[model samples]
Target: MNPNGRRGVELMCTGATSNSSWMKQLTSASRQGRHGRVLHLFFTSLRPGDRGAADTHPAAIPTALRACARLGDASSGRLIHGLVLTRFPSLASDAVAATALLDMYAKCGLVASARRVFDEMPRHDDLVAWNALLAGYARHGLPERALTLAIKMRGQGLRPDLVTWNAVVSGFALAGDDQMAGDLVRAMQDDGFQPDVVTWTSLVSGSVLNFHYDRARALFRRMVAAGNRVLPSSATIASILPAFANVTDVKRGKEVHAYAVVTGVEQNLTVSSALVDMYAKCGLVLKAHRLFDKMAERSSVTWNSMIFGLANYGHCQEAIGLFDRMLCDGARPDHLTFTAVLTACSYCGMVELGEGLYRAMKEEHGIEPRLEHYACMVHLLGRAGKVAEAYDFIRAMPLEPDCFVWGALLGACRSHGNVKLAELAASRLRTVEPANAANCLLFSDALASAGRQDDVVKMKRLAKRRRIKKLDGCSWLESP
Candidate 1:
């Protein structure tokens, strides 16, 4: 059994079957982000009848709902909600309990359900419910709806507080509306609320999402200049580090690292993961590995980042080893983890291992293959000169193969001088990416290499007729 499961069993052994004891464990697990443990404790404490441990300890229901929210287990959340209806019907009228239900639905991406709960709540004066619903809409890509709800909240005479303003600002910022986010910040300031770390972090995170790396850096600098007034939090550090990572700006990344250290957020999982990613992207893989070794905790993101860095820099063997270690550490491998490991297998020409991992990913881990995973498999087989086998794999794919899949096949065919398969792969690629001149250009080169002058001419003519010209590639160098 896993360590957590063993610990939970021990807790159950010592708790003497008391509902309060189970509730304490449930609340503790939920607070610690151990949602799975929270669920386990909650369900184990339940009896068959309506008046079970859950009814005796009504507070545990909201805590369980919160765990369901964190896990995105909407089915389980609904079960808990139904339990409340049947066993603890009075909880539906308690604002705190009802608000927890509303928040859970919102966090689970069930915005309509959240809105329904908000509308049905007995009290309209509860600003917590309003904020919960507002945050739900704001977070779920309906910034306009969030703003509308905020206005409606004001109409109900519940004056918008700092949290209310931050929710709206975050919504706009996250949606990439920098101008609107700025306007909201000024508006919040006018209303006697200054932009806090959360406010600045939202703007920084939005800038990063919108590919405004320079703007994100500038905003981070401004936030730092705020000095003791409003310090950068772990979220702030994590959000801004990606900008440096994407730009390969190691100097700036190092400065941020020093700041994280000074702020004592260097040990934070998210910040540490971002730091590893930044160092790796900046061509400091060894340094990244060192940092990874020093980390006391490693999330899936941390492992994936390190593995990708190793795979990308020709450390395929080490990358695969790290993946095994990740499994040993009991970190559940996600889609990205498979992608990184498969990439390593592809890079090292470990075709058999790659195939085994691919099957295991589906059969053992239950992670259905995504397009990128299929692309990686194709690349793996194609790189090993298994051109026909790669094509067969593509045919067996549940998804319609994208340009990357066909492109990998074509590139492999070119490498192995398989002109016939190259032509077929190029044709499919062109069909998928009709305006991509690179497809025609690649096929033209393949034909030229095979002494098919007429076919090469035809490919060039097709590109010219379609007005499809490959854009010139460029590179950026960070100034010293």
Candidate 2:
């Protein structure tokens, strides 16, 4: 009734009675490229952990495998693989089924098993197996091995498919070999294999993951220019959003938002949340909030983004309110949520309230304090002029304190004229960051407040000896 041939089978299901007919739908849906629907139908067809005749059901296995790849949920894929090994070992030898098995195993990080499966098979040289193994190596950051396998596949008179080419390109990207990746893209084009959104997204992701922000932005521009040639996916939008966030490029961020809206790319939950975070981080929280409110669905990530954005822009009370609303909405707050709210409390000098939330985080929420949470607590207590208690808190910490924890106390010492504690904090700071001129200056200020001019002069001389230049001040202003 939906008119699309793809949905025809669902209509047929109303009168379908036979188990074989149901299994037929599995193969049918997969062939129609309804991967998510295939998975949904597959799981619903049987109860969890149920397997009998369907174990060797050739059609069922491959569909499940494809679903795993689509979901990027390796655990589900591996479970399917385990079902195969346990039920029908012989079906694992069929070329199409075996190749799917190999691909699933490789993608799920069982490369060694995939290789063993490939080696044991009579059709070991099948292009599918070759591509699967190559992709495994490429995905796991073995660029050299992946490239070598590409050559070997060629030597064996096997032409690489689009998948093989993408894996190799992605491998180079993962290795931070941008030049090699670019060359491969050109070669791929020359070979008559036009890159799809996955291919371009992989390249963009590789650049972003490796901190090549400029290259990422340039690649995004290239992606936009070729948008007519290959439509970008939600993933492509998500991958490029962080590049705009890192640079605070609000103009480009707006362009990306428009692109996502125009392309319907923001329909995906991850992309929508990423857009929210990008807007929030680019000094555009109002825009971020509008998008957040508009999202029909949200994960903890979206809520965390709103909370973090509010705290970052000095909306402490609002951030705390949002945290309460998040809990009431049945969204469990993670360590990051607590860290953001605790930081807000610290900023607002609500020491008792901050400590209560810290305890509630562990007792009520069952989320243990990570280092950043401890850092927030230290900053909170220290800023309240309870320097001795802060020091004791640091000592009682089960985990080792980092420079941030000590730096918080030292900053407090400077504010409160606690010269003795400042000396201890400064001494520790020197071990952590000997060249930090601001910390040194703060230490000197703490000493000067106690009439210790000689120590202040010594601090300045030590800074001069180290030749550490003072950090330049930076501020933002809105243009009219």
For candidate 1, give the lDDT.
Answer: 0.87
User: What TM-scores do the predictions have?
Assistant: 0.94, 0.79
Question: Which residue ranges in model 1 land beyond 4 Å of their true spot?
Answer: 1-19, 47-51
How well does model 2 score by local distance difference test? 0.82
Q: Model 2 — which ten-residue stretch has the worst lDDT?
A: 1-10
What are the per-model numbers of colliding residue pairs?
0, 0
Best by lDDT: 1
Report lDDT (CA) for all predictions.
0.87, 0.82
Over the stretch 221-302, how does candidate 1's per-residue lDDT look in tens digits? 9989988999999999999999999978888899999999988999999999999998987789999999999999998999
The candidate maximizing TM-score is 1
Over 181-229, each residue of candidate 2 has an lDDT whose tens digit, in order, gives: 9999999989889988889999999999998988888888888887588
Which residue pairs show backbone clashes in model 2? none
